[model samples]
Target: MLERLLDNPLQDPSGYRQRCFEVKQDAQTDKWWLYVTYCFPAEATARSRDTVVGVDVGVSVPLYAALSHGHARLGHQHFGPLGKQIRNLQNQVVARRRSIQRAGRRGVVDKTARAGHGVKRMLGGTEKLRGRIDRAYTTLNHQLSAAVIRFARNHGAGVIQVEDLSGLQESLRGTFLGGRWRYDQLQRFIEYKATEVGIEYRKVNPAYTSRRCSECGVIHEGFTQAFRDQHGTQGRSARFECPACGYQADADYNAARNLSLVDIEERIRVQCA
Candidate 1:
């Protein structure tokens, strides 16, 4: 794959753009790696616009893509091992930093001259941690975005829809994922990649997507956080039950399904009125 993708623009300047290369060292492995970013002209796809693939960005799932008209889906288990790895890295960094802080404070408490190891070391450690976490997020975005585009192509979908999350940052104020800006980054990756392959990418209003039933268009007001707590379905619960129509499915997937509809916003307005 590397050989095929890395085409020499000088040798074959037909359809490839000038490639840019970056050299970086891995924070975990302390090994240098080279990354090449290249763009190649892609032929416009002949797929019809009848099929719309809706992608849902979530906390635990990362991404969930589904066809608007069919049950075809992708990215169900994309976050399993990879998401755990990111969380574990974050926890370790936080713990170690706290330990460093505690150790630094002990010298002042004991009234003894201490080795000034904490300040400089903490800065260095933080830089390394930031690099590692950023790299992990980039990797996750690349993987999930590729999966979304591949799913659309496999099903010959011409249009791809995602939630408009301009206001999600405020809601995500207390979360690590939100702090890292992963949700919008993931959507951007999908958008550019899909556009490169002649797929129309669009953002839809996200109101009531999670609570509205995809089948019957009923907005289940009972599916709130309190309802989830009452039913013990909080904290990454996969099940979403519509109280009105009894439509049940994975919550993220169901949201993706509703997003696939071009008329989702209009449906919500009509239903609520």
Candidate 2:
């Protein structure tokens, strides 16, 4: 379907061109919809320059991005009122489910049946809420990507270093920490936007990036309290410390530095190879 749509402009008999085309559909409410993008390239070029960006994904902010020009952009939309509403809805669903189960055990079928209906309604609402959250996240991810691209254009950067979040899933699975974080979707959006903007994006192993200090290369079990206090401690999903130097930054920044170092190493390796 996407391929057909992409080829539509070429198939036009009069040679008319379609510039902005989007595939979207109404899902539930009149205000809600789904968007499947098939953005066409305006031009083709292989000699485009690369821009380097470092991204840190978290549950609180979803994205903590640093461009190569020393400018940092934080994404806080994921932690706003919409997220709070989603949490509230989730709590209601859980309470309703529990109430239904209890009623079933007591042989009270009348209230239990109504409880089942309520659960269904809540589940339906939750699904719609999830779609809205997904849309918001998608928008935020693209904004971050565009910001990185703009920073690169302004600073003459050509390569971007992003942390590999593959293991995050395995680490969070089956825990209370699971389901709250949506790392995979955010990564996918970032990759797509990077490719669209012709930026060279690389993912490095995130192992110990948080625990290894960016300055002085000292490794610690956790970041010091002073370090946390300095960085405001709002988005420190990981921790690190450097005893040799009094360097203190968010664990995400340390990880970003690790990613940058890895990008440099890879470039050197490619040159050597």
Per-prediction TM-score, please? 0.77, 0.59
- Across 110-203, the per-residue lDDT of candidate 2 in tens digits comes to 4676776766665666666566656655565455556555654455545666766665666433222234445566567666656655666677
Worst 10-residue lDDT window for candidate 2 reads 42-51
Candidate 1's error at 83, in angstroms? 3.2
Best by TM-score: 1
Q: List the residue pairs that clash in candidate 2.
A: 50-158, 50-159, 51-158, 51-159, 52-159, 52-160, 53-160
Q: How many angstroms is residue 44 displaced in model 2 relative to the true structure, after the best TM-score fit? A: 7.7
Q: In model 2, what lDDT does residue 85 have?
A: 51
Consecutive 10-residue window with the lowest summed lDDT within model 1: 171-180
Per-model clash counts, in order, read: 0, 7
Top-lDDT structure, candidate number: 1
lDDT of 1 by residue, 1-273 (tens): 356555553636445554677999977669899887767666466987989999876534556788988898875465576566656756755776786676567545665333455555555676666777677777877877898899999999999999888867675433224454577778889988998788999999888887888888888887764454355434464468877778898877888899999888898999888
So what's the TM-score on candidate 1? 0.77
lDDT of predicted model 2: 0.53
